[model samples]
Target: MTPTRKRRLVAISMILFAVGVATTLTVFALQQNMTYLYTPSEILAGKVPADARFRIGGMVKDKSIERGQSLTVAFVVTDGDGDMRVEYEGILPDLFREKQSVIATGSMQGDRFVATEVLAKHDENYIPRDVAEAMGKAHQKHNVPEDAAKPSTY
Candidate 1:
């Protein structure tokens, strides 16, 4: 093969290699930060990874909020059919209250979830899509009418 042709081929090969490496690194970084959302029912059913971090979405169970000393709080999150206890050591959002939708990011510690961040529904009329689907699934499992599971505003 000609020297110029060989040089062009090497250059093309190097460019392809660099592109492949960049693509692989991008995917790796995304995977490291990716957090899957799980429903309370899914968590109760042991469908989540035992050690990996994830987000749990559900409604804050009524009368389940318990305030501990300092900024610690514990509450039960429910997706209608199942419940998971969540412990968080941070200031909860003002909109956070009983029966409100929430998504907590953390990992399971034994039978409970230890949350690093807690997100409350922004308004009475809005619910996260993941939480809504979870609630729908729970309702379906229990044979509860879908309307009954929805908030009164919806």
Candidate 2:
């Protein structure tokens, strides 16, 4: 083959290889960041896989919060249909309060959710779309009080 043709073929091959690598790396990064999502009702219904890292979101149960030693805090997360106990060890956000929307990412430890990271809504009526949708479904299924499933402005 001609020298110019050989050079063009080699360049094209290199470009294809680079694209393949970039695609692979992108997929790997996404896979690592992916976490299973569940609501309290789903977890109570045995939908959550044991020991699998996942995210659970719902309203923080009223009158079910307790602070322990250091930064450890225990609370109940409820989707109106059910409640799950969550244990977190970290600095909670100022907006974190009872009846507020929250999402906790962690693994299931026996009957409790051992959270690695906890996120709370900054204001009323500002819940994440996923959390709201999940809670809506659970509330509809169980006929839970709309006020209980909602993030209170109070």
Note the Cα lDDT for every prediction shown: 0.93, 0.92
User: For residues 96-154, what per-residue lDDT tens digits would candidate 2 score against the true structure?
Assistant: 99999999999998899999999999799798889989988877887867689899885
Off by over 4 Å in 2: 141-154
Summarize candidate 1's per-residue lDDT along 41-84 as a digit string, tens digits.
88877889779899999999999999999999999999888889
What alpha-carbon RMSD in Å does predicted model 1 have with respect to the real structure? 5.4
Q: Give the TM-score of candidate 2.
A: 0.83
Model 2 accuracy (lDDT, Cα): 0.92
Q: 93, model 1: CA deviation in Å?
A: 1.0
Worst 10 residues of 2 by lDDT: 137-146
